[model samples]
Target: MSEHHEHRHPHGHEEHTQDVRAHRGHGPGRRFARWRHRLRHAVTPHTHDSSDKVDGALESSARGMRALWVSLAVLGVTAAAQAGIVVLSGSVALLGDTVHNAADALTAVPLGVAFVLGRRAASRRFTYGYGRAEDLAGIVIVLTIAASAVFAGWTAVNRLLDPRDMDHVGVVAAAAVVGFLGNEWVARYRIRVGRRIGSAALVADGLHARTDGFTSLAVLLSAAGAAIGWRYADPIVGLLITAAILLVLRDAAGEVFRRVMDAVDPALLGRAEDALRRVRGVREVGELRMRWIGHRLRAEVALVVDADLTVRQAHDIAVDAEHALLHAVPKLTAALVHADPAPAADGPDPHLALAHHMTA
Candidate 1:
């Protein structure tokens, strides 16, 4: 089978650089292209350009980064407020919750770094790009959650054995409300951006913050228990928060582990196939592969076209296939479309595809 290939990525669209000269032009169009070309490369940290596929990837990553920084600011302020309450109340439950909030605020650091790294251009050694850094950040987030769980659990156990009087109960309750509001706001923003950007790691981070907000509410319960003369209530709530943290750990760990293993949503593959079939000259969809490289998605596909098509014609088909996938698949930053020659009309169909196959 004769194969012609086309590719695309981060800031621009490329039909295929099958012919090097096809990419170079003269006059005003060339000047405009040059500016956009420079902008795409300059904006993206990674060199995984489909020649210059500056579309949604650049905008999406930028949005993810903005969300991280904003969330960091909001959470930091919330943690500071809670810290003041912890100092005044001497409530260990509030202290544990405060610590978790601080850690949640700090998690934005790793996530932000991941976003920055993910923007770097792709190189020969890392053809898929540095998008995997976000997944690594997700690992850090999961570990932080686990650490918070252990710390909270230990404090709860210690207090269970030796209960202490909690002061400034009213102040602690008010602080808990502040923590909840702040964290919930950050959580919503993070999750919204993460989902829009197709970043599993960011989504996990948001969930972590949401969990912290719930723990903050638990601090409120601890204060109520103290008011009611239930000496064990504060520590019990702490222990419960620990259990909740563990549950969140399970979820975040599963998400990160799956991404580390390069697992993607099944629906994505279906969309890729549908997109390939929609192309005018794609006879049969052979093999389609997709994976998340950080928050951006990259795809590779094998497409069958009529055997008699010229190399140039096959290249055009591949170009169309790539363009279709880019438009149809969500969050897809790059794609490699390989056009394979189908069996001649008289020969037996080896791939045995359905009757919907296209003809030359």
Candidate 2:
């Protein structure tokens, strides 16, 4: 039996070119038709094709970069405000919160660099492009979080050893509120964009921002206790903030590690299998696998087809199956479909010799 392979990189530019030609006709209704087409394309989900995939990847990277810059600006302003309060009130809790905000803002630097690198085209040396840079950025972010936690913990311990009065309690409380508002806003924006773009690193950064917001609230509690004449409350709240940072660090680290290990959701595998099975002329769906390359997904599938079918027929079936998978699986940019001829019911296994040789 012969094996047939269908490798397709779908391109939709021809359709786009035709559309442009159609719009070139000078009729009043032509403008309306063109506008309608544009509206439909904008509102509809994008078809899985090479052109669209490239465009989507670039657009997603641009959006991620924007999110990082906007977050950095907001957090920078918030941290500066909190830093002033820290100096005036000498509140350990406020100081720790400020440190966290500053570290969170700086993390965007590495992520932005990764996004830029991810945009580079695939070369002979790096066949998959620079998408893995995002994973490296994630590691850096994890380390930054760990460092902030240690610094916060040490500062809190030192404060506990030598209790001190905090001045400008009202200003410190106001700064804490500002920090919370800024971090929450940045967190929401980052997480929303990250999920849409399928970026794990961006999502982890968003989680970090959210934890910083909660820690900022802890700073407010410290300010309140100080106002009420509890000298130990500030240091205790600082320690609590440190604990919260550690918790977020664990979560962020786990998420990044999963991405690095190419761990995809099991549901995606099921969906891919179901899509392949639904394709006409597919006798059976064999080994199906998917892995993430940055924010996009790639799949490899083995398909069983009729043994008597011509090579061209089997190839067509494989093409159809690949199209179905691209349509059904979200974020899947490419797929390799291999069609195998099914063995006859009364005949020896076609692959037995190959399997035996491999074992030997």
Candidate 3:
């Protein structure tokens, strides 16, 4: 067993050193172009592993916190503005949107707590640290969305049974616009950062915000129908908003469920296997597995090497394979590489006894 725990900083340093050497012979124009390229990658989300300027996990947590705080503030203000309109217009649609916005804003609290907990150092009792807190926060968010939907549906049904004329239709429309603008901005911010850091929780929150925005637009439509003397328009749109919430709830729930189940993208497994197979002296790559602990990744891989090689040689090959993986797989912080001897063609299978014992 040749285990290696790698972080982004060392690889970043190596890349920087190489960049400096490469730039020495190149013109300033080339250097500038390379700088722009790195900047683009830094700002945008992608699958390739690249050198990061800071510690990947910590920096990602920090970014997640920042996103939560900003989104919370924006949604808080938007909901407050809508709340006043709801009181004046007595529009069930506006009321439902406002309530949902408030709930969405409150979701930031749990996610912020999770991000903080994730930064704690690993302890003896919990060797993997508290990264799973983010997934828990995601569950909380999903439940919150569901609760909002239920409340909205109940209120809308009550209003539908007993229709009431709404006031301040124009004002409600303006408030709806405000809600749309605020939520759309928050959605873009949270989703971009979430994808960059690989945080499913944050991305779920972003999707929630996006649906809220569209529901807000539905409020505008409700106001228009109310102006045209349609008695049921307000409650009707409220029900529609509730249905939209349920749809987003499904998506967010699915994402959080996958994270909780330790599911990862199949492409990442392929990338890891390819990286391992490309390593020198590796005859075969076997039993490669990857899992997400929060937004970061860890891997375990088995390698087959020549049976005649010395233990030291085998160890070196494993180390090389691990290094290759660190560079090839994005967000991979650690890998455990186990080397096995290639079995002789006519001899008894070396792993058969161990495998049988394990099964037994």
| Clash pairs for candidate 3 | none
Measured with C-alpha atoms, the lDDT of residue 258 in candidate 3 is 93
lDDT of 1 by residue, 49-82 (tens): 4544554556777898899888988988998888
TM-score winner among the candidates?
2
Best by lDDT: 2
TM-score on alpha carbons, each prediction: 0.81, 0.84, 0.83
By summed lDDT, the worst window of 10 consecutive residues in model 2 runs over 11-20
Give the Å error, residue 285, model 3: 0.5
Please estimate how well model 3 matches the true structure, expressed as its whole-model Cα lDDT.
0.78
Per-model CA lDDT versus the true structure = 0.78, 0.81, 0.78
Model 1 TM: 0.81
lDDT of 3 by residue, 58-128 (tens): 88899999999889898998999989888887866677679878866878888899999998867998798
* TM-score of candidate 2 on Cα atoms, chains taken together: 0.84
Q: For residue 99, what is the lDDT in candidate 2?
A: 80
Would you list the rank order by TM-score, best first? 2, 3, 1
